[model samples]
Target chain A: MGNFLLVTIQVDLYDRLALNLEADLVQMVNKTGAKGVLIDISAVSIVDSFMGRIIGNIASMSKILDAETVVVGMQPAVAITLIELGLPLKGVQTALNVERGMDLLKTMIDESPIEDEQEYPEDDPFAQ
Target chain B: MILSLSKDNIEVVREQDVVLLRNRVKEVAVKIKMGLLNQTKLITAASELVRNMLRYGNGGTCLIEVVSRGRDNGVRLTFSDQGPGIADIGQAMRDGFSTGKSLGLGLPGSKRLVNEFDIKSKVGEGTTVMILKWANG
Candidate 1:
């Protein structure tokens, strides 16, 4: 199994399904030892606050497990709709397409500094 | 003259019904020859409001209609729920304000994706959100 999980949301997902997908993705990331997660949403035309939050949650959850996430292939209209909705998707990395997303993942994984310091707490040992 | 393609309301009582509502909205948008972008926006809005109905309104019904006024064709959606009505419609419409644990973009985001948006809620009664997206408008 590759160290990357690629998910292409092919439909306009309902609320429950999106939430399920987020759960599944996080579990999958842990099971597969995934170093990167790339979600392709070029086909997705719109995302509300709920959808936006799920997407953001996926990235955040994956990152917590030392995996980098990249969302790619956002349609122009979708981007505009998200912007107007005031959801900039802060802290989530985005790319133009799957191809570039893969490259970004490669770059991110290679240079990732989280793995080094994450396991070793920077706090003073006397505090414990 | 715009022939009546379809118009109806489906009860959204469960999770499966939310999916059904979105598909129904997509179907009506398709029948009206709505552009791909508009169709997506319509379906997205439908998904948002339908979920809102289920999560906040204790389940309800969504009215999906294909409307035409002269040369302009449109898809209209109306969601009504008999749940705890919003006490402050203005606060609910504001971005990033949520009573629940969400990004709180459901109402305002749905409003931005369509050509027309209207909301009416009476505390203790219920809430109704109506939207219209005209093709090529």
Candidate 2:
């Protein structure tokens, strides 16, 4: 079993470049065996469709890593834009702030039983 | 009164023209109090249309007009380009449909952002795309 890891991304309000962030988040989730990730976009005043897609992609990939993804600090306007654009964020959790997200993650970790004995057979094609 | 702004045949078909078009759209959007989010949507849709005209049509003119339909008040933008017109307007409207390496979100995605959309094209003549978005009263 992999050890728990935590990663945080602080999004800027006007930063337009997002492909790099998306790739990095996916890579980190795959490499760190993280239990969860917190994406803080409190500073972002706008969430364009391109940026929305990247965040959605990150959430989808993190699910494959068995890591939960939490979005923090989404401005009200950004949430409306996401809804208007029809970006699917069904499985992702959201919080009003990073502190709240951390508290929620901690609770989820404590209440959930650790799966230390889950093992894959050798030569399994899907084994990482 | 509705005002008209057009680019010279050569000047109209450029990526920078998108910026000019967006500015005009913003001006009209503000006059009607469309809110920031609605303005952004109009800008995004306009940018995509302008880019398509510049890249595919080699150059084209855009028209911006204000309109009021019953209780709805909004801006209408029409982009007309005289280049090798699209042979398949239906296919072009599909997501992931592109002649190049773009994400292919131009037509369909822009359509989603606007309240109303219309497109007319001729294979050899040219194409015109119209989009409308109303202010949220």
Candidate 3:
């Protein structure tokens, strides 16, 4: 939690950039040995399926490396777009903003073995 | 309508073209004062469809315009490609369906993002997808 990484994406990312980000993020997770990764995407308004999958992959990769990932500051539109894209963003934890994400990360780190997965209804958009 | 704008067209052949197309959609959405959520959804849908045009089809043309009917105003985007075309449109629209080994969320997922979606294709001719997002939705 104290060593979490904060990444902000400010531009519209093409496919290649998205792939590069995925690779770089995983590497950073391993190198820093951070307990959590917080990505601030408040500036990004649009999200395609490709971007959605890349985010999901990044979370999975980080989790395997013994790190928690909290994506913060997601615009309502982007979340809504991803939901409609049929990507549940599984295994990814989200927070309203950077502060809340940091708090969640700290709590997870303090609690150890963050195992609870808040379930959603069958029709819920974020349900995975 | 104060949002009347001329037709804007772009050619989608390479990966860069996809980004450009999405930007154009965003511009039109902004002109119509479409909400941030609507703009995001429209741009995302445009990105997916443009990539589909480049991936499955032999590159295509995207037409962007601000459309108004009576009192309703919205942004409309139509993508047309003269690629090999889809032999089975129904099968292609199913979720998690892909022939190129991708995630297969291009078509059906994009359709769900916009307010209006229409697709037409011929086996050997081409395919065209049209989408619209209303301002007040």
lDDT of 3 by residue, A1-128 (tens): 35998889998788899899999999998899887899988887777888888888989999899888898888887787888889878888999999999999999877774343333254488766
Per-prediction TM-score? 0.86, 0.61, 0.87
Model 1 C-alpha lDDT per residue in residues A1-128, reported as the tens digit of each score? 27899999998777779989999999999999999999999887668778898999999999999899999999987787677667899989999999999999999998767766775675658646
Which candidate would rank higher by TM-score, 1 or 3?
3
lDDT of 2 at A115: 44
Q: Which digits, one per residue and each the tens of the lDDT, describe model 2 over residues B41-134?
A: 7776776677788778887887777777676688788888888999989999997788975657778878888898999999889999998888
Measured by TM-score, the strongest candidate is 3
Candidate 3 lDDT score at position A102:
92
Better of 1 and 3 by DockQ: 3
- Write down the worst ten-residue block by lDDT for model 1 chain A: A119-128
Q: Rounded to one decimal, what is candidate 1's iRMSD?
A: 2.2
**Model 2 chain A lDDT-worst window of ten:** A8-17
Pairs that collide in candidate 3 are: none
- Candidate 1 per-residue C-alpha lDDT over B24-102 given as tens digits, one digit per residue, 9 for 90 to 100: 7777778777887887777777777888888989998888778887888898888999999999999999987889987
Return the DockQ of model 2: 0.15
* Docking category of candidate 3: medium
Candidate 1 wrongly placed segments (more than 4 Å) = A43-46, A114-128, B1-6
Model 3 C-alpha lDDT versus the unseen true structure: 0.85
